[model samples]
Target: MNRPTYNLLWRLAMPLVLARLWWRGLRESGYRKHWNERRGHYGARGAGWHTLWIHAVSVGETRAAEPLVDALMALYPNSRILMTHMTPTGRAAGHELFARHGDRFVQSYLPYDTVSKLTRFMRHFTPRICILMETEVWPNLIAVCKTRGITVALVNARLSERSLRRAGRFGRLMTQAAAQLSLVAAQTERDASRISSLGAPRVVITGNIKFDVAVPAAALARGRFLRQRINADADGDSGGAGRPVLLCASTREGEEALILDAFKAMPERPPGMLLLLVPRHPQRFDEVANLAGLRGLRVARRSTLGQDGADLDSAVEVLVGDTMGEMVAYYAACDCAFIGGSLLPLGGQNLIEACAVGKPVLIGAHTFNFAVASDEAVAAGAAVRVVDAAAMLAQARQLLLDTMTRNSMGAAAFGFAAAHRGATTRTVELLQGLIY
Candidate 1:
C-alpha cells in the first residue's frame, strides 16, 4: 500500500496508462463542448444529502445500470443518485439515466481516481454509499471512499483470468484497495472466487445487471423508424440483394481489419450484403471509416441514408453508424450480427442487443470480460464463438448462407437472454439493505 512503490509500478504500466490518457485527450478534443458541460460536476456539488454515487464507466456499464438505478430510487425516494462516467460515450449514455428516471439522478464525468480529485468528488457528493458497476476498481477512489465512511459495494462484478493475473502481481496494493469494499455482489460465482483470491470481501452472487435493463418501447418504435430510414425492407433485406446486412455493433479498431478480411474472402457474398459498421466510440467513427474504406468496399453513411427517421434510403451498403445513441434501431434492422471486439483481444462486444431481437449472434474467442454470459448463450445455442477471424468468417458465411440455421440460432439466443433475466431485482434487494 506504499504510495511510492505503487506509483513506480503504475509507471511500469505506462503503455496501458498512456493509452487511457491518450483516449481521454481525444475525447477532450473531439467532444470539447460535451466534455466541458459534464466535467463541471467533477468537484463536490451535491453534498449534505443521502447520496449513492454509482460509477458506470462506459456505454455498456451505463446501459446495465438502468434497472439498478431504478431500484435505488424506489428504495430511497429522497436519496439523490449521482452517476459518474469517465468517457464521453459513458457520459452521454448516463444522461439517459436522467432522461428515463427523472431528477432523482444526475450524471457526470468521474474525477480522476487520484487523491485530490477523489477527495474533491467525494466531498462534493458526500455519498453515504458508493456502488461501482462491473469490474472497475480505482485504488485512490476506494481508499478515499472507505475513509469517508462510505459503504462501498461492487455490483455486477466480474474478474477474468487476465485481470486476476494482472491484479495478482500487485497483490498488496490491489488487496488493500479491494478489501475496502463493504460488499461484493458479483455477476458469477467465478467472479466471486477471483475477487476473494485477491482479498476482496466475501462476494455474493447477484447476477449480471445487463439482463435487468428495460428495453424502451420508444427504442423499439425508433428502431423500426431507423430501419425504414435506411430503407430496409419489411422482409429484412437491403433493396437489391447484395449480401444480407451484417449490422455490426460496438466494433473497436484492430477488430475491423479482421472483419474486413473475412468479408472480403466470402466466396459468395450474399445479395444485399451490407456491413453497417458502428464503431464503439464516437471519436473513433472517423478512424473506423478509414479502416473500412481501406478494404475497398462501397460504403454508405447513416446520416445520408434518410433525412428523417420516417423517410427511406433503401439502397446503401456499409452504412457507418457514426451518430450518437441509435444502437437499438440498427440492431433491429440487421439480419444478424457479428458483435466485434471479440475477434481481436478486445474482449468482445455486447451480444444482448442482438439477442434481445433474436438475431443470430457471432463472437470470437476473446470474450473474457463477458465469459459468463457469453458461455451461457453459446451453451444454449443462442450464440456462436469462433477461435479467430478464419473461423469467424466461416461461421458468418455459414449463417448468412443458411436462413434456417440463422433463425434457429437466433431463437436460441432470444431464449437465453430471456431466461437469464431479473438481475435488477436481485441487485435492488442488495442495495435496499443499505440505502433503504
Candidate 2:
C-alpha cells in the first residue's frame, strides 16, 4: 500500500524473517554469524566516510556488479566502496572479488528495510551515493537515503513484463521508490520503458554491464587443467581425445530432475559424453549429486577433486560443480553449455558467461529475465532456445556431434559478447554525473 503501511508490515515480518535466516543458517552458517549486521548494529566506526555504497541482493547481482565495481574503483581512486548484501553467498562473492582492494572495499549485510535500521546504516557508513544493482528498489531504503541526502542510482537495471506486473500489485509503494532514484541505467530499452512505467524519473539505456565482465586468466588456466582431467581416458591417459562435456550451469531445484531424466532417456547418446551439472545454490549440491546417483549416473564432486583435479574419475558420467566463483572455468571446460533456471520458468541464469568463453550456448524458452540478451543472442546465431529439457539435450547432441557447427556458434558467441563490451564505461560515466 503506502510507505507507513509498508514499514509497519515490515516491522511485523522481522521476526519471521529472522527465523528464516536462522533456519537457512542450519545449512549455510554464514547467515547465523551476521545477526548484528542484519539488525543494523555494527562495531565502532574506525574508517573515513565511504564514497559509494552498493546494495547487491545475492550472488548473481554481486557477480554482475563486478565489472561496474572495477570501473568505479578506477574512476574514483581515492574513494572507498561499501558493498552490502542480503545473502551470505553474495557477501562471500564480494569478499573474494574485492579482496585485492583490502580495506578500500568493505561489506556488510543490508539491514531490514525499515527507517530506523536504514538510518543507522546510513549514519555508520555515511556514503555519499547509493548504487543498487539490478532490481533492488526498497521503499524504506530509498526513502531513508533520500532524507539523508544520499543520491540513489539503480545501475544495470532490468525489469521484465512479469516483474512489472508483480510490482504493479504494490502500486504507490513501488512507484514512489522508483521515483526517488536519481538515475536508472537500464540494460535495454524495454527495461527502461518498464522502469519508466513504474515511475523511475531518470532512466537511461546504458546496456548490460555483464557483457563487460573480463574472463579471468586464472579461470582460463583452471579450465585448461579441468579439461585435461575431464578428457582423460579410463586407462588414466590424458589426451585431446576424450568425453564431450555438456555443462548445465546454474540449474535450479526442479529443473535438475527434468534434465537428469532427459539425459537418461536420450537415445543413441554419444560415447563418453559427460554432463557437468552445476546447481545454482550451494545448499542443493548434495541433493543434485544424490539425484544423479539415484538415476544410475556415476557422479563426482568438483570439491572432492584435488587442486589439479588429478582425482577426477575418468568413468564419471556427471561432475557436480559444487565450488563457487568458478563459472567461467566451467564454461571454458565445456564443449556446450545449457544455461539453467529457464526450463521451469525461473527466469534463467546468465548465459553471457558461457558465450564470453566461446562456447555454443543452449537456453530454455523462459528467458524473460534476460529477454533482450536471449533473443539477440539467438538472432546472432550465438545461442539456441529450446522449449524443454528434451530439446535442450537434443540440441546439445547435435552441437557435440557437429564440430564445425559448434565452432561457428562459439565464434559467434564470442563476437556477440565482444560487441556489447562498453556498458561498464557508460555506467561509470552516469555514476560520475550523479556524484558531481
Local error of candidate 2 at 194, Å?
A: 0.6
Q: What is the lDDT of every predicted structure here?
A: 0.76, 0.89
Q: Report the alpha-carbon TM-score of model 2 versus the true structure.
A: 0.97
Instruction: Give me the runs in candidate 2 sitting further than 4 Å from their true place.
Output: 232-240, 307-311
TM values, all candidates: 0.89, 0.97
Tens digits of per-residue lDDT for model 1, 1-436 = 5656765665576567546666777555634433432323443356767778899888888888888877778778788788888776788787855666676677667765556557767777778888899888988778887787787889999989899999878768788988888888898898989999888865789888787666677877766666666555555544334236677788887877777777777776666566778888787787777776887766667766656435434344467888877787777777778787887787887788778877888888888888888888888998888887767767766777787888788788778888888878887777777663
lDDT of 2 by residue, 1-436 (tens): 9988898898899899989999999999889987999898999972585468889999989888998888788888888889999998999999988989887899999998889998888888889999999999999999999898999999999999999999999999999999999999999999999999988889999999999888999998878777777763332122236787899999998999999999999996777888999999999999999999999998998887666637567678899999998989888888889999999888998889888989889999889999999999999999999999999999999888787898899999999999988998888988888784
RMSD of 2: 2.3
Clashes of each: 14, 0
lDDT of 1 at 283: 74
- Which run of 10 residues does model 2 get worst, by summed lDDT? 231-240
